[model samples]
Target: MKINRLLNNNVVVVKEGEEEIIVMGSGIAFGKRKNDIISPDKIEKVFVMKDKVEYEKFTQIIDQLPEEHIALAEEIITYAEKVLKTKLHEHVHVALTDHVSFAIERKKQGFQLKNKLLNEIRVLYSAEYEIGLWALQFINDKLEVQLPEDEAGHIALHLHTAKLNTYTMDETVSTTVLVNELIQKIESKLGVKVEEDSISYQRLMTHLNFALRRVSEGKPFDDVDHDMNELVKEKHKSAYNTAVELGHYLLESYEYVLPPSELVYLTLHIQRIQRNNGEEV
Candidate 1:
């Protein structure tokens, strides 16, 4: 690969064929000028970014980012990919790099942004939330800056945002609100509180969050299985009844209707939470 631009001694924007990609390695760009061919042995990492906007954002931030911070963001993304089992949007690398770099700067200045949805994030995106918490420790060890729990929530939000490909802060907050309201409506109809820390509750929160996003985007769930829906209604009457009530609430308030399959899954989740032991009620 030929060097297109050098960000630093260890990092360079290189041209491979017709595409520009960021390559990182020790001494990869040292004493190298534009059009210099990089040795394969010196290259350690390459961000094969395909998003044009994401590539631009990366170019803008990378020059200002600390080498350690970039490495940390790369590690976090790799770990998140393994946990999430999905390919992340490329912007996550640049976005997370900016977030972490500025977060450290803010910490040194004694300024921290508060995440009001921390509780909801923990309950709803528990897997991502745990990854966020892990990132705090990783950041602390790698950068020696102790970021607060709020930063963890921010990281978790970034992870969630990456999965969706695009999300605004307002949309995240609105989704949280919808999930909370939907859960309350279901609980009220069922005459029992959904255990907030339970596995079932987390699963429901995750499903509802995605469902709310789909609803907001005007995406209707058309793959409803009528046979399974009738089966759930017959086998889990109370849970299905609770789901129906919640469905009505969504229709009345948000004009969002759950597909029959989603309703069946919701009923199963509700029944799981209601069960005292392995046995069904």
Candidate 2:
């Protein structure tokens, strides 16, 4: 490969065939002047060009970005992959670079746009967002391309969703705990003690499972009752009210919004327990 532009001693922009690639490492581009041949061993990542715009944009950015920024970008990308378990897709990289360039320009113009989203971004993405920011700096400094805000928002949302998976798992665990507690409360209040291993408890578990399933499927509570188990009607009114109350409590306490279908199941369980204990409808 031929050196296209030198970002620093350890990093260089290289042209392979018709595409430009950024090569990085401790001594990858060391002592190599422009137009010099680069050893294959020194090459790290070869960013193949997907189109003319990408090539032009990348080349332009490489020309202006400082060496330290380039190194930082590389470090960020590496850290994000290892820590966040996410790969910054190529489109995201391009978008981020553009944003970084704009941020710097805005700063130079005395317009301070505090990227408070950076904190949420870092927390959600672990460290991948940091790498994205570094890449943005490189793009801004080298290519002078300003990234769009919408693109950055989309990238951040994607990272946030990945982080949300953990929360979802926690929600599942909490749902189980809440269901158990509610059952205990009902048994204690009604004086009709049902064994934990009784058929009724098993059936209640089934209803709870269905509720969780509905939530996952995004079904609405009003629409969730069709084709439901007939046994659900035995305590329909109480179940419905209990489900609604529980749903509201969860939303208020943990910001968890249950889908309609799950609400129906929870309501069914609540009603069944209340009716079995001779509670008035």
Candidate 3:
């Protein structure tokens, strides 16, 4: 392929047929310039860019990061997709690589940040958490530094964000905190403990997660049934009131306004949890 530009001595942008892509290999562009032909055997990794903006972002990351960091992050992402059986958003390439690079630097400087949502993430997103554990081991094996398991939860959040394409890393963390707070509110208002291992608890967590996603994206539940909503409120007054309070809590705390349909569903889930705990709904 003919070189379009060089990101660094180890990374080059090249053209193949109708597509422009980034290629990385050690010393592949050591003595090369624009329009130079790259040997096929010298290419180690090929990243396909979606547009000019993404191309530029990828180039900037390639220029600034150590080759090993980029390669390790890409390797973890690849393994995650294989195990999870899905294609993640392309933004993961830049986000995860940058995160890994910074994380490595912080560890080298003897700095560490604990992931507070580690338990919630491990329970709520078990699949991604498992992959995170794998990534920690992989990093330890490849880099020879034992990164804390809390980092596994952080990595899992990144994979989950990429899978959903909903929020950035920071937003994801905030959302997780909100969900946990909502659960606590439910327990306090309805006077019921939600056992994490129970199916009822799992359903409640899943529903709240997607409910928040819908609200944040400004997409409310469609085809709302007025009769059912009224029936749910009338039959389960305590649970319905708890849902209403939670809605106000979201609005006041996070500026999230829950729709009427969302409120109905939330009340039903709350009633189910209360009933599962042998408490009056």
Clashes of each: 0, 12, 0
After superposing candidate 3 on the true structure, give the runs of residues whose Cα lies further than 4 Å from its correct spot: 8-10, 16-19, 25-36, 50-57, 83-87, 123-127, 163-166, 191-193, 222-231, 252-255, 276-278
> By lDDT, is 2 or 3 better?
3
lDDT of 3 by residue, 189-259 (tens): 87777887788777887788788888888985765689998999999998899999999988998799998
Name the better of 1 and 2 by lDDT.
1
Please provide TM-scores, in order, for all candidate models, with all chains considered together.
0.73, 0.41, 0.79
lDDT tens digits by residue: candidate 2, 87-199: 54444334434444455566557665544343333333334455455545555566565544333433344333334223342443455555555566556644577655555
lDDT of 3: 0.84
lDDT of 1 by residue, 43-155 (tens): 87777788888887787787778878887887888899889999777878888889988898899999989887787899877788899999999989987989999888888
Candidate 2 scores a C-alpha RMSD against the true structure in Å of 12.8
Ranking the candidates on lDDT from highest down gives 3, 1, 2
Report lDDT (CA) for all predictions. Answer: 0.82, 0.55, 0.84
Task: State the lDDT at 267 in candidate 1.
Answer: 88
How many backbone clashes are present in model 3? 0
Superior candidate under TM-score, 2 versus 3:
3
TM-score of 1: 0.73
